[model samples]
Target: MLNAKWKKMLVGSTVGAMLVVGAAGAAFAADAASPAKSEKHAAKHQAKLEQKAAAQGLTVQQLLDRQAARKAALEEKAKAAGLTMEQYKAQRQAEHQAKLEQAAAAKGLTVEQLKAQHKERHDKVVEQAKAAGLTVQQWKDRKKAEHEAKLEAKAQKKGITVEQLKAQLAAKKAAK
Candidate 1:
């Protein structure tokens, strides 16, 4: 009963509608797949946490409580800022990147160069720690103690208290 022009229009509309539906179905399928991926990732993270807790001689519940407390603190901060957690995290990440860029500029390096330099230093430290049969944290603690001893010695040589020396150093840093 339709004319040739009407038939063409009907066919075109049907094809367009089918294409839209197909696209929607594909998007829905992708959204559905994301949850499975997230679930797997979450399970792996939980297992890692349990392993870490066992290594540290802490109960899994204790470790989880610590994590939950940290998360609650972050959530409260986000709420105070009138932002969702994701938005607050994104804002903080952007600020961190800006600080990195500023530091790199001050050091006459590109951001990538600064990052690479940091990674190189970190890798060297990790290698040294492994060679010395010390964990990274243990190595860092030893270095910190040595540095504090040197600072204390310097303070004594200058006839200044440690707190006064620290305040002077902080003032110099702020001046810079």
Candidate 2:
């Protein structure tokens, strides 16, 4: 009965999602198809998708399907390991980050160079956030609390132990 309720909700929600996505796509296409579409918008859209496909060595559809499959597999693995979705995501992110570092080594770039680049981006975000009336550290702390609150709600809904959820959240926070 519980499973059926979830399946029903999922199926019903997907139809609404598809309609929203389809409407957005149609609007974008109509705007782009206009004779007056700025060259900048058209070129940006064209080049962005083409460049992404080339970088991933995949056709656009293939890339999308592969990403969806990877997400599904990750979710399945996380369930099997008794982890919440966010915990598994963080673990995969760390693994992929390590792989990127190894790839950078092959290109003769040092870890220090990567760290410098990361710091530059982080500093830019910090400046932007400060300009928007919040310090970067304050923004980050707020986001972290909101995320934890969301996970706590999910844990409660799933009848998970609060202590276990707290421990998991602590581990995740420490990892950051």
Off by over 4 Å in 1: 1-47, 50-63, 167-176
Query: What is the TM-score of candidate 2?
Result: 0.30
* Tens-digit lDDT track of model 2 for 1-176: 56988999999999999999999999998987775666768788768877677654567777678879998998899999899899988988899889878976976787778778779998887776667666565667777898888888988987897678888879999998
How accurate locally is residue 62 in candidate 1, as Cα lDDT from 0 to 100?
Answer: 94
Q: Number of clashing residue pairs in every model?
A: 0, 0
C-alpha TM-score for every candidate = 0.62, 0.30
Per-residue alpha-carbon lDDT of candidate 1 for residues 14-82, written as tens digits (9 for 90 to 100) = 999999999999999999999999999999988999877864456789989988999999999999999
Best by lDDT: 1
